[model samples]
Target chain A: MNLPQPLQELIDQFESLPGIGRKSAAKLAFYLLNVPQDRLNRFSQALTDLKVKTHKCDRCFNLTENKRCSLCEDEGRDQSLLCVVEEVTDLLVIEQTRKFNGLYHVLYGRIDPLNNLGPEEILAPQLLSRLVKEGGKIKEIILATNPNMEGETTAMYLKSKLEELRTKKSLDFKISRLAYGLPMGASLEYADYGTLIQALDHRNGF
Target chain B: MNLPQPLQELIDQFESLPGIGRKSAAKLAFYLLNVPQDRLNRFSQALTDLKVKTHKCDRCFNLTENKRCSLCEDEGRDQSLLCVVEEVTDLLVIEQTRKFNGLYHVLYGRIDPLNNLGPEEILAPQLLSRLVKEGGKIKEIILATNPNMEGETTAMYLKSKLEELRTKKSLDFKISRLAYGLPMGASLEYADYGTLIQALDHRNGF
Candidate 1:
């Protein structure tokens, strides 16, 4: 369309994001152009900070600034319990409820067979190693993955693998799954804090 | 909402954008965070470049890098016929048709009394001055303002002002208003190129 190279480049970048189409990209680019210079600079700086400053916690694989995430490092949190979530954002969802005081383990993804993403693709090996190494201190491992088919499969896979580890290592840690009162196929992002809190409270053993 | 400082900063910036609510802002911020570093950098650079490189054309007030806009500088375009639009995006819409060879004048805004915008708020006075100073060579002034209430009001006001200028300066140019065959209250943004071209072709003299 002979748009200025900068404008076209911006549109292409915006279109690369999930759920954003070419039309929406163009709209966003134009909107950015109209915004004040100081605001644009802040937006750009935020992007840089998000990439440069944010890092995955070694213990939980959650986005964090330190080796251990806030939940993992907090002395007041229940170190004996760990909530396993599919993504870092899911951890944020759980945290917003102000209910869960336990630590967390983020898989960063789910087992999507259609996309050829199995257990290994989601850092399951690392999680198993962590559990085996720290099995005595950990009292419970809560499977809080999403309620979708992939989430269910991942949970089942994790449960069996943990069971196998327990049989081999003779670990006595309890294994559980978050309650499924949440509507099927809904993302943790959309679920209200109250519902998520209730679901976490009523979690059942897997 | 105990979001991390960096994440919260990004969400706040997204919320500052026009038409973006808190929920949508959070979604957009997360969407940006998920984008690859290189892509995010490119988008951020594009935003800065859009503001730094783009400038209003001296003659037409349309967004351009050069002193005169591409349309205004083109020798083959009909200098005698000028199309006045409300924004630079509207100029792009007209240019895409390839049917009109006329120069464009961007008002940057429409006159709305409710917003305390009158004749001085838009480019009406400057356009009238240009018409009078261009001598008898200029044939037509096409008022292609948007079809909304503000656009209609601006067009009617401009028509009267131009008529008064024509009598006072003894100029012989014909002032025309672009046809509004499309549905009322529909923005030029939503109109297809073909429909817009048809509307432009069927304009009537005011």
Candidate 2:
């Protein structure tokens, strides 16, 4: 492939992306070549600004330019309830629901022990300290991590730690996990056994 | 979704790429966010350089960093034999085969009236002038445009023009189209009718 040096470099960059392969990278590179020069520059600026203009919030670890994220700064949101999530992406999905008006604590990752990713790397200690600093204002903490194995383990670990803190500090806040059940628009016949079992155990009245 | 402004902008940039949807764009943006800042800067540089460091070849319209593309500059290649292709991608594919060592004239596009694209938009005049300038040195011109409708129309159009030039200017170059047939490793049972007909029409002796 006698592609120009810059074109070949762009293809390599695209190939480094998560889902894009060598062929797709070449296609993307060619597609970008056709885009207007100004538009390509804008795309480059966006890539450069992505990291420079964003940082983790001091309170919740959610991505933000300021010391605290917008959600943490909003007084109208329910400060009494804090939703703990594995990443900012998860927090964004929950925010899209328009149901949870509370604040969030983004762990930034789950505890995958096999990969050597422990609770410490995910800001678990920071979450605990933030909880202690919030004092009794936060009445409930929702363990809204993913339902997968790593998420479950992280949530359980947080639960035990929260309980110990409650006993030691005489705090009154309660810790709870998200409910397990079949998702909407899913057929019962196609549901996996684990999902079916969870749905059965946490079944609600009709 | 409460995403940072820069993060959202990067997602929009990714979404603008061909074949990437909003979901995939968001995933790509998030994935890039986790990458080290130095790597992000390098990716940005690649995007910036894609247009800044490359331009169309003066001779063949193929992409190049110089006035003429490497293929057009190679003295070892068969200058007397020229292959006309629809785009640089097609030229790259032919180059990968390593069978044809001839020069190329990239039309950059085919004749598509539906899209209002014509010969003028595809550098057809330049190709004619190039052939005229070469005098009688070029012996053959292979119409290697794709076999689809637009490609076939372009090939036919070029063939008639070349014939007119040959007669009017007393040139001696021969024009030829790529042989159409069932592709290798393709089962005849699943071959299309058009391909089957072409295979029968152009059958070769063992």
Candidate 3:
């Protein structure tokens, strides 16, 4: 008697996604319905496959299809330098440039006290442990976390924690945060390629 | 040395969706990777199931799981009055109010000559045949097509065609169109419920 219940249900599901409101969700649902059955199937399968086939690298926390991420497994990469980011997408953006030969550590999220997300909620502990355990091979740690309030706070927290680890172990590896010339509050994912490259070039000691 | 090739491919596919764009698509793809496998499967299956489960109603051309749409099958509906719309989504909007007990005919699209979409492209022939085939049981045809140029042109074309049909059959039935006091160039999907109801109430004979 009304819109097919399944169609409405799907539209509601889409609306629940981040950045999608009611109107956009409805349009997306209708567009999906109109797509060819094969394309829809492929799109759906891709969503399911993303979860089934991919996982966080135990070492760096970047998404991977194997036990360790491609960066960690690649012998040609500069193992002495590591770039840390807030999410896997950030890693992908940096990777697209073909400039960074270092490994990456995905925090999975940034520290947001307002959202009840703290240092422990992210992969901070694991990242610190990896740096300490592999202190001999890694000469520098690049804090490429996003240039936002939460990102700055998280970077500061990690910097202090890594400093404590270095003092306790008598290690001398350098730790640095990304440059702040980028527009404030802008996500690393949306930063222009040139801005990201410039930020990476101007990174300084934390 | 980066995100897996398949994962990158999947993100590119998400970007291809309408209104998804690059940044939002990456977010969605990453979100998909983070979601539980079972939940991702359900979302993916829903996408494919939407098109597979729904089919055009033979009688009204509305999206339905059966031969006749729920509105057409309902016993309480006033079969004497029919509300014609451009799409199934539009029909759903009117049905949400529970005020119109009449049946519906979905033309699927309007007559857009500029886009090479004419009457034959949107099931107009079937609509006219249905009106004539209903015999004297149908007393009124309410045109609830949109208010855009294509909508207006389609309504006028349908009005002239229906008039010819009435003259040929020697029948007496009122033909009307929903009022246009609402804003122009806005889709029926975006119209508030109150506005749509008022437009229906103030409908004028074509």
Candidate 4:
């Protein structure tokens, strides 16, 4: 109850975050107590620069400090393939799979009407313009949003929008969604009903 | 893959703390991006002051910014009783119980032999000096260390040390340990064997 002011404030700030609880907040505040003043200053500087120095990439809406993100500037990656992800972290997850070697479009968030979030709230227009401006370069657009309800809605909306662009400009690029199936190492008995239905509906001969 | 410098640094710092992993680190970094610049400044200031402003209280070794912690300075608290704990956070946990009205002596850490931590590494000497200074005023000493092996070892060591001090000063005070029992709402089948044995050994009148 008589915790020092700054320590208590730090704990309060930590508690305000998404997953941190009261015990963890206290642990972190006390753990930070042992860190030297110089390290604390560096941490503070990092926090200050976290918001001040970072901005969304103009082209891809990915996090970056420059006019464009590194992925967009890198000429080594495949330019004809574009992966659309719900957030920059999803792009990171895709990158970790080491299977996708193309550019990315970060939507920043998905459309969820129940949560009062609409197309205008996110980076939907940026994605539209990027598609329009770079139509000739991109050959395939992969919709990699989450497989949940909101993600399905966003994917459908983007699919229609991409379809309209393709028809209007007669773009040669293909619009595709990630396939549904039981994940690797998953058992069939425990698989969700909708996923199993999708897998059955889209089954292919080996 | 293309995270900016400051955001990456903050993520790395967050990852270095206990219990935080890579995914949570990135989530925290990106979440901090949405926090306003003024709020970020306050959070940064709190980090700056966490170590710089806090030090161990000279009397009880509880964390404080002043000469003595508020608990030690409070005249309303029972001055005749003192609770010895392994760390300041342990004292906080006991405070949450709202059953203890005595002062506390924080040893700062348990005797973790596997981690190369011993009595000398923590505030054991400070506790000894405090006991010597205030032995006449204190009538009861409670060893409130954890119930695990290391905690039991630390409490035994402290008990012997306190017994030596009591013999040297001919101190007239009682030393006690917390009662062993089945905790409220704990299932008998789920209780560990050692705890169950201790409960049986310390069984009192029904």
- RMSD of each predicted structure: 6.5, 1.6, 6.7, 2.4
RMSD of 4: 2.4
Higher-ranked by DockQ: 1 or 3 = 3
Residues forming the 10-long window of minimal summed lDDT in candidate 4 chain B: B126-135
Superposed by TM-score, candidate 3 places the C-alpha of residue A138 at a distance from the truth, in angstroms, of: 1.4
C-alpha lDDT (0 to 100) for residue A42 of candidate 1: 86
Candidate that scores best on DockQ: 2
Best-to-worst TM-score order: 2, 4, 1, 3
> Would you list the C-alpha lDDT of every candidate in the order shown?
0.81, 0.91, 0.82, 0.88
TM-score of 4: 0.91
State the weakest 10-residue window (summed lDDT) of model 1 chain A: A1-10
The predicted structure with the larger TM-score, 2 or 3, is 2
TM-score of each: 0.83, 0.96, 0.81, 0.91
Query: Could you give candidate 1's per-residue lDDT for residues B1-206 as a string of tens digits?
Result: 25666777888987776666787777877777777888777777877788788777777777666676666777888888988899878888888888888887888889999999988878777887777767776788899998778998988998899889888988887889766565678898999876688778876688
Scored against the true structure, residue B71 in model 2 reaches a CA lDDT of 88
Tens-digit lDDT string for candidate 2 (B94-195): 999999999999998999988999888897888999989889879999999999999998999999999999999999999998999989999999999999
Clashing pairs in 3: none
TM-score of 2: 0.96
Candidate 4 lDDT over A17-124, as tens digits, reads 889998899899989888778888998899988877888888888888887888889999999999999998899889888898899999989999999999897787
Q: Is the docking of candidate 1 incorrect, acceptable, medium or high quality?
A: acceptable
Task: Tell me how far the alpha carbon of residue A194 in candidate 2 is from the true structure, in angstroms, after superposition.
Answer: 2.5
How well does chain B match by TM-score in each candidate? 0.79, 0.97, 0.84, 0.94
Q: Model 4: what is its DockQ?
A: 0.71
lDDT of 2 by residue, A90-153 (tens): 9989999899999889888889999999878888898888878888888999999999999999
Off-target runs (Cα >4 Å) in candidate 3 are A96-99, A110-120, A146-153, A181-206, B96-99, B181-206
